[model samples]
Target: MPRARNTGSRSPARGAGPGRAGTPGRGQGTPAGRGQGTPAGRGQGAPADRGQGARGRGPIAGPSNDGQQQQARAPRRRRFRPGTRALMEIRKFQKSTKLLLRKLPFARVVREVCQDVGGVDFRWQAYAIMALQEAAEAFLVGLMEDANLIALHAKRVTIMPKDVQLARRIRGPEKGFASL
Candidate 1:
């Protein structure tokens, strides 16, 4: 036979429950230490009225209908590190900038290379593509800058293949620049 459980009934007495008598959860009704009908700030242990509780309207006024503090709460902490968030924002801006600049010439080739490589996870594939695109863009910008300098040195307004070849030669194998 199964034994019946004790399911005790609650009493309304001041010392009825788990906590100390004056504090909350000991019993129902208003908390034990507070006085009835006296305006707030006049109660036991309340801070002296800093001119706000005279009309019973501001910070010095005791706990309102609910028991929370009237002052503004502290700001919540971020779940991620500040640097990680900043980097994510920078990545978003970079992606937007790439879209505004028109499609990259080597994006298709990068995607093909990623596809041909084995053991590439889909999650890291986008990151890998972005990294490659950034490296390519930076390299092209540097090369163009150097080529423009060479063209200017030769007293020409336009950059020619020779200027680019000279820039590549100057960069050399040590810098990973290939001959045109």
Candidate 2:
């Protein structure tokens, strides 16, 4: 066992009453309660006795322009989906009065689509490709418009598969979108 240190003098724990002896028992804390050496939160002005909230500071203000304070604006977000941007560009092209450009799918995609859907088409014809391209463009336009409306209704910026499915239902009865 270790022996207590001897300094030729002894004192009660700091802030303990003069009548109390030895250090305070475990978890008993100071005789007066939680705020040992400081005053308890009895009133708003108790800080004077507790020694807190003494720092003198003023409200922080950012840099100003002239006499008018400038408000920060949120940065605009750019859409990432290739489909949305392409559709927007297509709409812009359609609205232009100066030039009318016919945007059709590349021959490779058309051939692949044919082989997958049409099948047994060993020989490709120009008229057949043109018809398929037009139909595909029409289906895409209706699908995107419907799906965009659905997403907007849900207060979301992203188009989900469910939105596309809903769009398909809307376009199911339409003549041009019958294939969809």
Q: Cα lDDT of all candidates, in order? A: 0.59, 0.56
TM-score of 2: 0.39
Best by lDDT: 1
What's the C-alpha lDDT at position 101 in model 1?
Answer: 31
lDDT of 1: 0.59
Error of 2 at 94 (Å): 3.6
Counting clashing residue pairs in each candidate, in order, gives: 0, 0
Model 1 regions more than 4 Å off: 1-105, 113-124
Name model 2 segments beyond 4 Å from true. 1-91, 96-105, 116-121, 173-180
TM-score of each: 0.37, 0.39
lDDT of 1 by residue, 34-141 (tens): 322233434432343232543335565345765454345666887996579977976786676553233445666665666789546333466666777677777876
Residue 131: error of model 2 in Å?
1.6
Span of 10 residues, lowest total lDDT, candidate 2: 51-60
TM for candidate 1 is 0.37
lDDT of 2 by residue, 43-159 (tens): 332232343322213213545454432335555687677688887887886796532225344567766776899776667688876676666666676677789899999999789
Q: Which 10-residue span in candidate 1 carries the lowest summed lDDT?
A: 32-41
